[model samples]
Target chain A: MTVKFNNRDPVYVQVIQHFKEQIAKGYFEPGQEIPSRRELANQLKINPNTAQRAYKEMGEQGLIFTEGNMPSCITKDEAVLKSVREELIIEAVDLFLGSIKSIDVPLSEVLEIVKKKHDAESGEAEGSK
Target chain B: MIEVKNVEKKYGKKRVLKGLSFTAEKGEITCLIGINGVGKTTIMKAIMALTPINSGEILIDGEKIRKESFEKITFIPDTITMLPQMKICEAFAFMADFYKNWDSKRADELLQFFKLDSTERIANLSKGNMAKVNMILGLALNVDYLLMDEPFSGIDIFSREQIAEVFTSHLIEDRGVIITTHEISDIEHLIDRAVLIDNGEVLKEFSVEEVREKEGKSVVDVMREVYRG
Candidate 1:
């Protein structure tokens, strides 16, 4: 798929975040073979060293693993998969709350609006199906 | 590593580079960024020994630049260095005859990658195509370092896109690349380090990732602080 990176954060960090997002969305199934470091660098137009760093960091975080000379693959650990899902949800909620905290709207109104929007999106997904 | 230590240069009575020093490491892309008339091109020329520096030293892998060093580093100037009358194929032949490191297979691959025709005359090619040919000639060489002077400058958007695509390809990997450009956005994500220059002096040298992590700033943001402030 498509990953759009912002200019603010370090690219390697963003790359890790992109993989996490993909995994959380069930796009990258557990044990799926990911692109090699060179392939990742070419696809993202980043330096190979940066891609290597991203993969290294991902490995450290248990988001991916490598065996011998084989290419890196998504983590098959259920604990890591659960944590990744929780991490993304927490990040999304933190962002949502941080943004709404500065506004004049009440929490109840914001929750109602979010609920309506969520239902609308769910309805659209079902309609498409 | 390509190191320029305390480089000083002058044009007639005017001093251009005043104690300029920077190191571009192997396996990384170091960008030399500054406004016009700030000696960006002069630094590239000095590195190539095209214009002799008034003082200081430039070392390639810890030795002074010499004829042998020429085989290890390739410099692609902004303008056409080849004879304007020569076609793309003839230019390739000329390079092959001169440089022992020239790789005909790599040149052929780059020619196809840039979608350049070998029979097309250099003089008749558009500015973008000329830039591509210039890049192809340099990249076809098996060199440890590549110095590019304004590869993205004065080119069409489509040509710039094509050139940007080449940066990600395997063609230029694992080489120390020193690129001087005012248009930083074209290769912003691709560069590993940024050396900001102002009035012949290096204002700052920082890794792009360091700036992004510690200061939450891009190279352009850093440039604004150094140049505008």
Candidate 2:
């Protein structure tokens, strides 16, 4: 629930991004209840209007839903959830590729290093578990 | 809405407010930002009718501020105004007697929220506790608009953060808040709009989110461009 927000980006946009990341990471399950805009504002130490705006945007994007008097909940649609995960993966890979492109390394060599790093990190995670 | 239109103020030969204008809507926090002596406190005082303005008009909702406006608005000065010998509960009794809008229940709630001991004397309070007590005096009222002067200034970072938390909590409700501060880094995210002042005039008045959305800039970035450009 804690987010160290950057000052430059619109706070509502950052909030939406945070929600998307949580959904993609499986931390927010499908159809899970979400905090009310006011509660979110208090918890995040952000303006209530910004939190409201973020919720409105999320509703429009089908990332969350509200029904008569009930608290808003994460979208239960599988396609939307799948797309959110794909979107985050693509974004992270694009950023990584952009950084690697500046170094002019061959794709084959870069993929080999990526595979090795990924395996080592996953192995550590497994050992910890 | 609290409308301050083309307001001007003077002190002896010096002009403090030069046709400053801004509107603070209910349910939003409008910040008056400037360094020391740029007339931020002067504007708050003018709105409260604590001082005379040379020209222009100040309005609450639509009508001009009057004796009854005190019921609709409250001002929290930077310092605690209670007697040093008074206990925290005694100060609450004083406020309850003086202001019809004072809510003793909410005052008690704020005392618990701040973790302030009701039996503690004002003279024994640390600077941080005094600031919190000052805030409670203003906030424990059934008023629509709240004006605060330098609530975070000259306090510890932890105290500053605690005060900042008040802005986001239900304690504020939908009250129109006009807060003056020379320092904004701590509560920048909590305000709806910022009115940047320099030399008694508004340099820029903008919605904080709109600036970030449209110009890709933070409040500090705009301040740098306006103040140093």
Candidate 3:
């Protein structure tokens, strides 16, 4: 999976957001083993301390957990998984609404455009499959 | 910790460092940033004691710099330090001979990581490959503090990316690093603190995260404010 990070925010926060997005998209399934902190740091080209901080924050958020010395895994709790998914959806909708509000277009027109875009994307996905 | 207190240096009649002072704490990457000819390298040279200071003092871990301290700190100059005629393996042997802390296994690992063949002559390698060799030489030594002077200078984008990747890996995790670079974008996210230098003086020094949190400014933004203003 490819994760593109914005330079404006703290890197660990962006790393957590990337993992959240992956989890919400079902790319990282529940109870799947995630990369170790060092591995993640090496892959992302961030400081190892930043990777450790990201993992710690993710653990605190109940998004991932570690057992003994084993590597961390995605949360297996259905409630946590559902909340993570819903939170991402809400965040996307809020961002979309905020951006659209700055323009002159009405909400209904923006919704229509989004519907067309979504349908076209899903159609392309089905064709590829 | 490496601390420089009111350090001053001069060449002939021209002063290079004018009462410059800063601290690089243990387990942190502190970047020394400024435009070219702003004495960024001068400060690094003074810290390494490669160049004599006119006044003031530099301390590594609360002790004055001495021959023994040289073993504790490794300085990687921007240009290649090894003889141009030496092959990569010969350079490695040179380092192994001089430094008691040199780890040949680590050197071999870094050589493989940088995709450098030990048989290649240093003079024949590309600019990027030469820089990689320079980095590997400095990193193979087990030292508490690593001072890199413009490690990113005059390198290609791909080489810079490879060197930047080293910051994240276990290769540099425990040491206190003080790196001087005019190009901050290459290491914007990796640095813990930035010491902004202008005219041989530290204009400002602050933790990067604190600046991001309090002022919503990246190191580049802060540089613009300090330099442009």
Candidate 4:
């Protein structure tokens, strides 16, 4: 739940992004209960008002839901969950491509290096496990 | 809301606050940020009526501050106000005697929250512990508004962090907090609004998130523009 928030972005926006990343990474399961606004504020060391704003925004975006007098939970909608993961992948790709483009690397060359590095990293993970 | 409308104050030959004005609303943490001797504390004292204002007015909930206002608002100075020889419990007792709105239960809760032993004398506590005790005394009061002067100043990182957590926790729930600080890095995310002052006048008064959202500027960025621009 630790997020080193950048000061330029709105805190509530960062909070939403953190939740999106957690959901995409499967760290937060679909329909899993989330901390209340006050609890989240205390945990994140942010203002409670900011936390409430985040929750309200998340609710409007359908990233989370709340029942009557119940705590908020991650969206149980499978399509939305899948889109969250896809959105993160696209964002990472966009960032990588943006930086790689500046280096003038060919698409084929970049793909080869990425595949090699990713495979090696996964192999190392498997070996360690 | 606590409103300071064109408040002016002078110290004998020196005028510290010149037409300083700002409003701190209930359930928001408003920070008064400026360099030293910019009348941040003076503005707070004027709000509390600890120092008489030469002109203009200070109001709590639309009414000028009076004797009854003391019960509705509490001031936590940078240093502990209790006697050095007094034990923490004794200080609590003194507060209970002086302030009718003092809540002993909340005091005990805050004591545990800070992990302080009430039997220890104020003279024996560390600087951080003394600050914690000072915060406890003010927070334990059933007040709607709190004015704190540099609650994070001159403290270790961990102690400052603990005090910052108090701003988020239920201890500060629903109360308007006005804290003066030259340092804004520690609790930038915890404060709702920032009132930047320079030479006893408000240079900028804006919501932290609003500025971040609209202009992509952090509080420090705004401060840089206001103070150094």
Candidate 5:
């Protein structure tokens, strides 16, 4: 899959997001070996140097890990997974809080609305299954 | 790799670029960004042999480049380089003859993607379309690198997005692209690395994430703070 540069946010961040999306989609399983720098760069149509930066950032973020000559792989660390999940939840919570605050809506009303929507969506999914 | 070792350029009394040195590895897109009139385009010109450097060493793939190597790289100056009256097809044919690697199929596809009427004269098209056409040609030429100066300038929002996407697909792996522009917001996400230029000198160079991680700022907000100071 070729990586497209849109000149909107920055290239390295987009690469990081791409990797996360892949992981979330199970395109890359936990502990799965990641592609080498050159291979990933070629596949994404990006510079190897940029690809290197993405890998480095992923390692620092605990999304991926490297050990000796065994190539980098997705991290299956429970603690790291918990942190990422929390981060995603925090972002969603912030947005949800912001919208409710802007309209001066009460927390009770917002939670009730969220619960209703969640139930409806899960109900639809169960019916489909 | 493209290296600029102690390169210098000046116009009359004003020095545009001051002994700058940086390397753009193959398959990377390095964006030269700065406030208005910071010599971003000057660097691109020096790389493409359009303008002479006052003093410095310019190397491409570790070798000094010359006129013969022009085919190896393509340059699109911020100011549209092609003649205004040149028809779209005429410009395409001209480049095809100039560079042997020019892909006619790709060129045809890009022209149509931009929705440029080849039969309609270039002068007749709006200024925005002209910029789009200029970019389409530079990108369609299969080369080791493509250097673009302000490809998004003089264009509205819709065309900018369309043109950017087209340029994105034209990039071949192992080939680098350098773009210089003042409007960093729109194209900020497209660049692999951001090179900040100021007063003819490079202030900083980092991946998009590094800037955010280290400075705790988005590129747009950081740029505003940098230039305002």
Candidate 6:
């Protein structure tokens, strides 16, 4: 997963965002084994305890599962994965709604903006990195 | 009662704590808030006698936090790991044997609240489960003060809600609690007083009501500037 800290929100929210990024990037499939807390902790250099916390949170949200001592795994059910992805997309939309909320943009207008921006950004996307 | 006046700490050449002073009274839940790596934990450790400060005097209820006052205060930091090899059913008993303040009744109640199978080995418990154990021990103790650093950082949001409630009713108002955490939103409504720290210094102290009226900002937002980059 891609974990990054954002001071604007709580750390656990950042963890959830990281999980969403992993899902988007195809590194974590619906039914694949997630990294163990210790491994992730070593990778991120945070306390193993904090990484364990992220895993525990993910499990509680039904995004992943672990049977007691079993290694924690992402829910591999395709339907479940699609649904979680949809939830993430909705969360992102709501986060960015401020841009459109005040303008009272209809669905068609929003789609037009999106379509226009996509083509324009695609031409310059690689340069952003 | 705790006091630190004009205290300073330096890690080699880098100054962590500048001149700082703050007094935490009995029966008060004083929250300490700051950004990361600001030495909030170091101050707590100093209060707990876990770490010695280079220059500072930490007094508890008029007496300095020396060998004698250590037992009067209880500290539960984040990630208090019990020996993974042991079971809670056994370890609870072991803790009872050591800490005379331990109350078996409260511990049992907490075990039920957490729905923990006491027979399950500590290694088998989830992070949330382990945090529950730590929470139980802190509540079971009969002490004048409890200090916790980042207690909510390791638990799920749902569990954090439960723990916050537990903190409200179980926490003794006649005693005291000093909590250091980055999750200010989690405890903003719970804590009565706020202690804002930065670079190991006390920047401001405001009552929950005082902060709202005087600063026109939540304690979290007010303190964010103190630890601002």
Model 5 lDDT per residue over B1-229, tens place: 7887889998998888899877787777788888778888788888887789999999998888876677788888765666778888888888888788888888788777778788767788887888887777877877888888888887899888775664345354468888888887775554667788898898777777566656656777666666686
> Model 6: residues >4 Å from true position, as ranges?
A1-129, B224-229
lDDT of 4 at A116: 100
Looking at model 5 chain B, which ten-residue stretch has the lowest summed lDDT?
B165-174
Cα lDDT tens digits for candidate 6, B153-173? 868998887677565453444
Q: Cα lDDT for residue B120, model 2? A: 98
Q: First chain TM-score in every candidate?
A: 0.92, 0.95, 0.88, 0.94, 0.73, 0.75
Cα lDDT tens digits for candidate 4, B103-151: 9999999999899999999999999999999999999999999999999
Candidate 3: residue pairs that collide: none
Cα error, candidate 1, residue B104 (Å): 0.8
Q: What is candidate 1's lDDT per residue for B84-170, written digit by digit as tens?
A: 999999999999999999999999998888899999999999999999999999999999999999999999999998898787778
In TM-score terms, candidate 2 sits at 0.97
- Model 5 scores a TM of 0.70
Clashing pairs in 1: none
Location of the lowest summed lDDT over 10 successive residues in candidate 1 chain A: A1-10
How well docked is model 1, in DockQ terms? 0.73
Error of 1 at A19 (Å): 0.4
Question: Candidate 6's error at A68, in angstroms?
Answer: 53
| Per-model DockQ | 0.73, 0.83, 0.67, 0.90, 0.17, 0.02
Error of 3 at B123 (Å): 1.8
TM-score for every candidate vs. truth? 0.97, 0.97, 0.95, 0.98, 0.70, 0.61
Give the CA lDDT, 0 to 100, for residue A64 in model 4: 96
Off by over 4 Å in 4: none
Local distance difference test scores for all models: 0.92, 0.94, 0.91, 0.94, 0.77, 0.74
Shift in Å, residue A52, candidate 4: 0.1
The fnat scores of all predictions, in order, read: 0.62, 0.77, 0.60, 0.87, 0.13, 0.00
Query: lDDT of model 6 at residue B215?
Result: 52
Off by over 4 Å in 3: none
| lDDT for each residue of candidate 3 in B1-42, tens digit (9 for 90 to 100) | 999999999889988899999999988899999989989888
- Residue B172 miss distance in model 2 (angstroms): 1.5
